[model samples]
Target chain A: MNNARRNRSFLTDEDGSAATTAGFVIAGGLTFILLAVVLFTDVPIIGPNEGEMAPNLEGQIHTLGAESWTNFELYDEVDGTWDAESNPEAKWFLIQFMDTDCPHCWNEAGPMSDIESNFGDRLTMISVAVSLNIPSHDSDREEVVAFQEKASLMGCNSGNSDCSTRSGEPHDWAYFDDLDVTIMDTWGVQGTPFIVIIKPDGEVAWNQGQNQGQEIMEALVEMLPVVEAA
Target chain B: MILSTTVVLVISGLTILFGALSRTEALRPLFSTLGLGSLVDEPISRRMIAGALGGILGGILSAVWVWVIQRQEIIGSTSLCIPGSGCVAALSQGSSNNLPFTGLEFGLFFILLFSILGWIALTLHLDPKASNALRLLSWGRILSGAGTAVAVWMTIIHLAFVDDSPAICPVCLVLLVANIVTFAQFHLLYTSHSNGSWNDK
Candidate 1:
């Protein structure tokens, strides 16, 4: 049949075979170029990092004395627009991402409180309590309140019989409940006890990811004086 | 996840090899039992087969790229997207759109399975002596139609239902386009073969 003969001739034809080879070569080359572009390009990230402006965060703040949660926004406290002379009243912000059920966060609570006590005059510490989505680590507003109660008792007078009582002053800082973990996603927090220091002008001075292996206290000690001098 | 990624990569490599060496006589016996031995004798069918395989490869690569970006996000690292660009916004929003498996993962799995079925169909259609050629060709046509339908639905979701903010996901778009092209090629191959364009001799 003519159709059969044509099919046979087409396969044996040198130009046809060459065209197929050229097409494959071009496609393969383009694929390689695309892969290279994806792998090598320096892409900017939206989340917080050292030397970058922190993303604006809005949440419900549970101040220690307040009976109900109050709305809080980061940009309200710290001006986002850069100013050479930072607002003296707008203290440096120390933001902590913690989970009530995390052991590390529990252990770090005492030290974090001590840090707050020392830096209370120079910085405003805010704790953003979040749920890690693990079954055991799931938290609610009540759990956050309970965790605050326990943290308030860390350095209380143990010699007294009423030691269990929350007579001691609670942490003199705002606490926010992120039970939905939306704030965690916004901050790209992968684990608990993540900390970030924001300048009065809203720039991130230090982030846990950028300052690997450095404790929050150490970073504060090293960076706070520089921030004050500036 | 890493293991599955490796498997997909290997399959993609083998498909490319098959397309490139389809005309070699040494490979004839290997595919003879599958009725694909005469693929070397028909230039048009050979090109169609190559096109389909190329689309599969593109889909696999795009899926892998998405998987890598997602892994970076999980580790709290910066993904591959320019700041203030649509890709960055899309990546930020993509975290909230969580499923048990990512969309790219499901797409990869579907395309890999589809590639296997498509290969069998193509070989069957080309084999003039195959007794069940017409029946298998009908199945191929139906499968391709279904694939096209799914691609269109997903494309609609991507374009309209993703979010209020428009997300320009170049990689996701590439993967969807590859899916459409692969199915279109399959439909064409089945239609041509069934219409008796290829000689029975």
Candidate 2:
């Protein structure tokens, strides 16, 4: 009779219901914990807001945002000089973000020569050596020289793998600056071969990674201060 | 490949957890507190990781597609990584690898690496205690999971093709293969469990 009575009491108890409630509470608590981690750090599920203004790029004036493109100060290693800023008449900029060690960039010297020939006075090209881990200045200069020669560039190619034979020569490009990686953090240009052509007004008249040679060249021609005679 | 098995397990686990959280209205408030749904609906919670994988996998797959597009004329990407070629020396691109061949080499490597490693991390993080299997094993459900990966890979290659971009990856195609193997396992498990014939099956 005692055993039977004990069984009856156990069946009537609220432990099962209490356990269910406890599990629900635990799930609830964990949900809050994950949310806490998410709120502070980046979480994919909660994407960054869209239509938000892009962050300002470092090493360039924020006002450049108002225009299609902005100018960067470039220093010539060989001439030990600086490229002049926009010809008040300059209307387009061919901006290239490259790495000194890039093989593709080396190959690009050939096409680049073709591009200069094709566009002539209509384009103002700018190329930046963007690297997070900067090397010695002399080494960087050598790499640039090596890059030109490897690609058989005019004034660059002297038929030698070792660039020591020919001194580094600056292309007709108007600007050359080391990449400000902070600009990558700010504008999020993490990848290399990133290029943008800004108009006289400083708007992104043309932009994409490298390999868009034709498109970039065409955009520059269209944006030039020079107009075709009817 | 057995590498595919692991991807299936993790994705299946995620699907179950997602379904349960969505249905039990109470679960949402807690997830919201954790900031789970700020970027996408709760449905796409794992998509960022998935999207990154898509890019990687797509590059790997593009090897074969690129080989096809280039015809038998050439066996490599236009920009190759030969020491003399300068494709691999710098520039953040994958090796100036030839397609299909590099695809097989790097493809298998990354697939094994990504599939196994990704599965381990996902399993550890996925809330197993919270899953609701009954909510996630429909015919359509499995297909959607596989489709998400396939679509992402195709889109990347499409862009690459249009841009004449180099260094294609086969990440998405391999990931899709991973998803297929994974979903099949889930189907097997769900079927076995539901029939109460798990022991025999």
Candidate 3:
């Protein structure tokens, strides 16, 4: 009976009730604040945000000078070792950092091909295939090689991996395999389909990001005379 | 996914409402299964109700937040973290990551809706003459409780095993902890009641 009486008293305790209510109020308020923050803001408090500088890979990857195009060497399924700087046939280098798996990169290929044909001997476009699948979303070398062949980006034979030399009509452009992303990281390319036009002098003339395929070629067209004048 | 989420939310919301009412006879078995087998004699049904509602609130908030993050991610935006908070990296690559758990959000929204209904039902239960109508409300607790349990489990797994980075949303986790505490309080109330240490009369 005594225990029953005490239990009854506890049940009606306004102090306990008030404390519980207070706790709920505090929790609800905090949850509201969190919801607002997450919903309204961009850039998580923990992750990388936009507006960071694009990496400049001048000396580390390829020196920025006349030798920039001919000296830059990347592996090709056909050519084994393709040299960009030694290609005396081209006057400028239009280097792009792309991933085979990236949809945007695939979409950008048409405009890039147009730029290649239109520029003729004025430019040597090099498509640097960087595989992003390392550590997390890892892509293999085969995938990259296959991407190059299907897209017909130039200088790679997808059907015959062991076959050397440009089997078909050698694409006017060049391709480089950066499966390790050594060049990408050095250039701070966190996204795919990044385009940068380098003059024969090795100076960065223009670079476009995201859905800038048209702008990229246009920029190349605009920079043609600037390169010739130098 | 949306349909399943809705079903879970509606059921959980009903269960939470039922748990809030004073019909211990219907809820006795449930309490026992929830590890609260002590409500036969003494009763702390009010505390249990409070705990259950609290858990629902937290769970709903978490579900909503995750849904929002997914939307931002799709738009090529990052979910903002508190400055210098050192949260883990974004869940995945921005362009490629298709956000998961949209259904969870839908469920949480309905749970919130049901909770409001439950609160109204509780008011009616407090009236002496309206007790019978409120009995139906108690049945909803099973759904609510089960849904809360699932939400809690999913959140824990994401935090524990899925997240490889150190960054975590403290606010989301804190609310989840609050929900867990609510669960504990519910167990405590029922256990105490059965053990003859608590009374709701």
Candidates 1 and 2 compared by DockQ, better number: 1
Q: Which stretches of candidate 2 lie above 4 Å from their native place? A: A1-90, A132-142, A145-170, A209-214, A219-226, B1-201
Best candidate per TM-score, number?
1
Instruction: List per-prediction Cα lDDT, in the order shown.
Output: 0.59, 0.38, 0.46
Q: Write down the C-alpha DockQ for each prediction.
A: 0.04, 0.02, 0.03
lDDT rank order: 1, 3, 2
Question: Fraction of true inter-chain Cα contacts (below 8 Å) kept per model?
Answer: 0.00, 0.00, 0.02
Docking class of 3: incorrect
Q: Considering lDDT, which of the candidate structures 1 and 2 is the better prediction for this target?
A: 1
lDDT of candidate 2 over B83-166, digit per residue (tens):
222221111122222233444332233333333323322321243212332333343235534544544454344335322344
Q: Which residue runs does candidate 1 get wrong by more than 4 Å?
A: A1-114, A117-139, A142-228, B1-46, B75-79, B93-164, B194-201
lDDT of 1 by residue, B75-147 (tens): 2233355444544334433323333345543343444445544454434433433444455556656765665
State each model's TM-score restricted to chain B: 0.57, 0.29, 0.44
List model 2 lDDT by residue over A139-226, tens digit each: 2433543343342333222222343233233354532335445544444555655666644333344556433555656665565555
**Model 1 chain A, poorest ten-residue lDDT window?**
A155-164
Candidate that scores best on DockQ: 1
Measured against the true structure, the TM-scores of the candidates, in listed sequence, are: 0.44, 0.28, 0.38
